[model samples]
Target chain A: MIKVQNLRKVFRVHKKPPGLSASLKSLFRRDWIEKVAVEGADFTVEEGEIVGLIGANGAGKTTLVKMLSGIIHPSAGEARVLGYNPWEKHDAFRRQISLIMGQKAQLWWDLPGADCFQLLREIYQIPQQQFDHQLNRLTQLLNVGEELNIQIRRLSLGERMKMELIAALLHSPRVVYLDEPTIGLDITTQKAVRDFLLSYRKEESPAMILTSHYMEDIERLCERIIIIREGELIYDGSLRKVIEQYAPYKRLTLHLQNQTLDESSKEIFSKMGEKVQIQSDQVSIQVPRKNVTEVAAELLRKFKIHDLSIDEPEISDTIEILMGGKDLRQE
Target chain B: MFVNLAVQLVVLWALWTAVFAESGKELVGEWDLTGILSYGVMVFLTGRVVRGGDLQMAVASEIYDGSLSRYLLYPLNYGVTKYAQQLGNVFPNILQSIVMAACILPFMGSSSSVDLHVTGLLMCMPSLILAHLLFYIMGLLPQLVAFWADNVWSLSVLMRFITMLLGGATIPLSLFPEWSQGALAILPFRYLFEFPTLVILGKVSVNDWLTGLLTCAVWCVVMSLLVIPVWRRGNLRYTGVGI
Candidate 1:
């Protein structure tokens, strides 16, 4: 369980201009600007709930997680994970929760994942039997049994992420904070990670707060979604509700029998929908949920329809809209 | 520490033997086989006790990686953890220094003046321990600069070089000018190496010993107070960049 009240994190960043002269000037008189990374963000997560913290880049998702996990203190407000003040970092608090950042690894790079796992086992003070059981279960779930013995640096990104998950989960902490857990993984590996989280959630019922740009990760593993923008919480509710609120229009694609729809006909359909676009033999339109049946009937009667399909806007598109058209393109 | 000392000892022996052969059987000063071997022990111990690489690396890394937030979150004192790590590093460095001394011992005979008084040796232990602590803290203070500065490599290098020079790891402080010696005497650097070496060599007066020990204590306190405020303010300004 987690509770956050008006969480705020402000960062003072040094500002310097380019060029040798500016650099030299900065050496004598440095300048700094205060930026709010997370501002008055508030949310609560119940035990056993897997909540996705979604945002565009610079949305303060990681900042929020860091505060909750005791990695960094908040600038103001309060956060408690499992009734423990995170920033206080009591040993008991740390023992009850784990934070895993995908981009930044906790593994010993040159050593085998096994060695890192052993070291963590000692650090977490897990019993030998329990450690073995957890390791076996995690490795099997992540399908990384064969890769554990090899040095972490030798493993692929996906393999390394799998081991990272195992290392973080070995202690079986009740609260898991995962930041971009599935980033950079291939589809299959992403699915594997998703499935592992799903199963782990079902078994342990640990409270999980996952932050990622990948909508598929949220869709597969998180029923609840928290959307933040520019350090403020914009949306917090069911994932489906978030989709409905931001992207209410349903997309309908009608495949025609080699017939090009005229402008007037496209306009006719457009009159019944929000956006209408016609290609060589297909007509794609975004219609409101209430007008879908009417729009479909109109299209069926007006066009030489061969095949038809309807799709709700993707969660990714909904999130993009929620963030006010901020770019989510991964580099 | 043992491995490192062994390597240093082997290198010292080879260098000393080459120097001896080049000198045509004539040894330097009263530092014959015995004094030369004692010098090796002194150098090795000074080098080990003045070790700053680990502390520098740890601080630099935590600053660079933004993992220092992890340390800041803990309830335990950061100073304690830093000292613990420095203590851990001392084991290996001391072991290595001893091995280096052993290698030189075979080439140099035992010295008649190499006497260890029980009280002096006992006092020397705590003094050296305090000196090592002071050196570690002094080395660490520069690393805290990494929080504000982009990179600490130059600063760390400068600190190491100063420690080697002023701490008398490479040259004895006694060889310096009286004014310079007096300045070094009050500084923590001299306490890190020169004080302990003098104590071991039975060259320290009781009053000088007390002054050196008090100087080291004052430095430890001063550095801690100075660095903690800087570290706290730096953390406030910390962006946790590149996360």
Candidate 2:
């Protein structure tokens, strides 16, 4: 339900110099710089799909979300969310979409969370029955029923974030932009939030774009992933495809009872894999995916192996290598 | 709050009383010593009723910090929402101002110049409401520039001084020269305080009240229209940082 084509945003910012003299001089003759926050971003999200937008810090992930949610206008290109240009900010389109920022608390600090929801109810003009049903179901899903009456500022960060989610979903928006929704939460709370999102996505079937630094969140929630780097979309495809394409090697950790640390055996292990590290009783190596089992069997037969493990490399490390301009594909 | 208001009223009474004595005249323009005293009381109460808090700071800081992001996503008019927030801040002061006015009116009401009529007060409410809106937009327009500029706090501070002088919060507008009064009557500032003060004093004819209300209403429309473009252009400049 979202289509974007070369969507771009450029910000004109004034440049100033340091020192008292330069500061005074800048008042008379100022310099200007145009910053491209989002450069020619191209992607589309379909209904009932969750797209994980992955990037490091300052990668314009939030900027793209802001433009799509109609919080800010794009400097160029076109975007249509739910068949309406988001920049035009049609009320009908706004009612159909929600943007949740983890770093920002959108509810009133002094008011109870329920009061904030009531205010949103009036703003969106949701029918009374729908509002009540949604509120009950969302609060139940998030397990924040008793916390709703407490002032938002008094609640813990995790509790407050749950209230924020309920506030965003009360109108049952057709599109959702979750920007670091699990940020700053404990592991248990993060899992709770991710699980709640999974349930909500299943029931509501809204097109979702989740931007987060946490790799576990992406691995759990998204099948299709888009990677952004320095305001440009670098990779966009199925999560498994990207992993398989970028990381074609698996790691082997072996423990042997009679393995020797001699140079002759080290040379043999090196020929079979990459980055071979050998110990008196253990050895670890990076082996190509197809050769892992063969290498493990060879080591077992040759050295009285006690244990072995074959595992994929961490996807986050592979992404970091990709972002650093390294070739991840061996072929 | 009550004690502070009481002390400020005493100070205003002393300053105006001394000015009348130093002038060696029983009357100065349309306001006698007792009349200016009543004006002081009105000013004391109306100032709170008008400038309830630092509205410009509230608007500017929210924009600068990107708190405006969430509101922009909502299916509601942002301007009306902000205006409602400003009104909410001032609503308590309105109640206090009424109570304070009732207490001080007993002392100021014994003079011939002190005229309190239900008709006058009824007429004054609409003008006061219009003036409140006009002044609110005045403050809000400058702060919307925060979307571009780094800071706009000084603009609101400057507006306060200009309103105090032109709107006649410190001195009665009747004291201005006739030529200046004619122009000031048409300006939006006079309607903010001077026109409402005149209406409360039962000094204006029905025609004058209607004309004043119409002028204030027109300025409200003109300024509210101006907000649309300024807000539109500024919203594009907003980066929604810090969120």
Candidate 3:
């Protein structure tokens, strides 16, 4: 279980100007700037729950994960993972949690993955029987049998990421923080990773926090999504609920047979919603969420329609709009 | 590796031989030419064994490259892990140094006359281990500055020169002036090389060895205590970038 109450982190970084004189001046006197990486974020994750943390770059997603995993201390507020304050870094707490950063590697580069696993075994003091059982199951699930003996640096990026996941989960942590776990992987490898994570959740039922730039990953893997913008939690709810709250419109693509270039029909379509596009035989229009079926039926009865299709707005576009402050609800 | 070590020994022999010939001196205080040659051999071998391992840059690199985050996420202590890695590198070099010493002793003009001093070596084992730890901490302390500064290579280069001058690496402590020796006696550098070499050669009395051991213990404690706050502050400043 994870409980965070107004967690915050502020980093004071030195600012330097260009030119040799400014660089020399910085050695004695320097300008400082305060960067608020995470600002008063609050969320709770239940056991067996996987929540997607969505944000633009520098929106404090990684900062929040770092704080929750005890990699860095928070500037204010508190976070508890599995009944322990992660910043305190208690051995008992650390043994029950894991953090995986997609850009960072936890494996030893010169050594085989097996050796790294053995080292982890010693560090976590895992019993031989349990270690073997977990290793066997994970390797079998990820299909990384022959690759484990190869030196990590010699392996491909996807294979190395698989090995990283194995290393992070060897201890069977109860709380997992995954920051872009599927980054830089090919589609096939990404699918394998996603399936493996879904199956892992089924088996282990661990509380998980996932952050990824890929919308498909969040849509497929996370039932609940939290959106953060400018270091503040903008939205926190189910994915479908986000669509309803932020994007309350649907798009209609219609194929016209005999209805040609007509200004009156164009005005009617525009009255329904915005005219997305108009071609020789096809026309697309945006409709309010409630009037989608009614508008489609009206078009079907009035015009010589060859085909009609309706689609919901994309999650990516909705998030982009939300992040730009155009569609966010007022406080 | 062996070739490098051999070449280093030859260079050291040539340098010291030139110094002795130019100065027109056969003895330094109580040590004769042969004794000084033996001391030079001991210092070379001991210094190689202590400083040859590759973990000297461990802390600075981990800080700069963001690998320290891997250790922070675990329950393990970074210092202990690095110490273990450095120790693992040290034992084999110690064995090799002993072998090399045995092979070179006959050619140094002592003709196997120098005592191996097995009992004294056994007595010095604790002091040597403590000395190794002291050197490790001292080497690592300056590197912790990497967390604040962008480059600490100069600190490492500077440390090598300081250790060479004060640690009795290139020259024996007794060869220095009496007052300089008295001043160096209060410093930690001499114990890293001079004390261990003296103990190995059976040159020190039992009381003196005991005193050296106690002094090593005190320095180890002091250095170990000093590393705590430095490491704590360094960890706070670490951003774990480029990981």
Residue-by-residue lDDT tens digits, candidate 2, B68-118: 888889999888898888888988888998888888777764556657788
Q: Which regions of candidate 2 deviate over 4 angstroms?
A: A267-272, A278-280, A288-302, A306-309, A326-331, B177-179
Cα distance off (Å), candidate 1, residue B161:
3.8
lDDT of 1 at A48: 94
Give Cα distance to truth, residue A157, candidate 3, Å.
1.2
User: Candidate 3 has which clashing residue pairs, if any?
Assistant: none
Off by over 4 Å in 3: A258-272, A288-302, A327-331, B111-115
Q: Is the docking of candidate 1 incorrect, acceptable, medium or high quality?
A: acceptable
lDDT of 1 at A275: 72
Quick one: best DockQ, which candidate?
2
Query: Candidate 1, residues B96-173: lDDT per residue as tens digits?
Result: 655655565465555654544556656677787787778777877788887778888898898889887888775467
Taking all chains together, each candidate's TM-score versus the true structure is 0.83, 0.95, 0.94
Q: What is the DockQ (computed on Cα atoms) for candidate 2?
A: 0.69
Q: Relative to the unseen true structure, what is the C-alpha lDDT of residue B186 in candidate 1, on a scale of 0 to 100?
A: 68
Candidate 1 lDDT tens digits, A1-331: 8999999988877799899999999989989897788999888999899999988788889989888887767889988788999876688888778878888777779899999899777677899999999999999888889998899999999999999899888889999999898889999999989999999999999999999888889888999998888888888899988666567689999889988667787678768887778777877888888788887887889878899998888888778887885433221
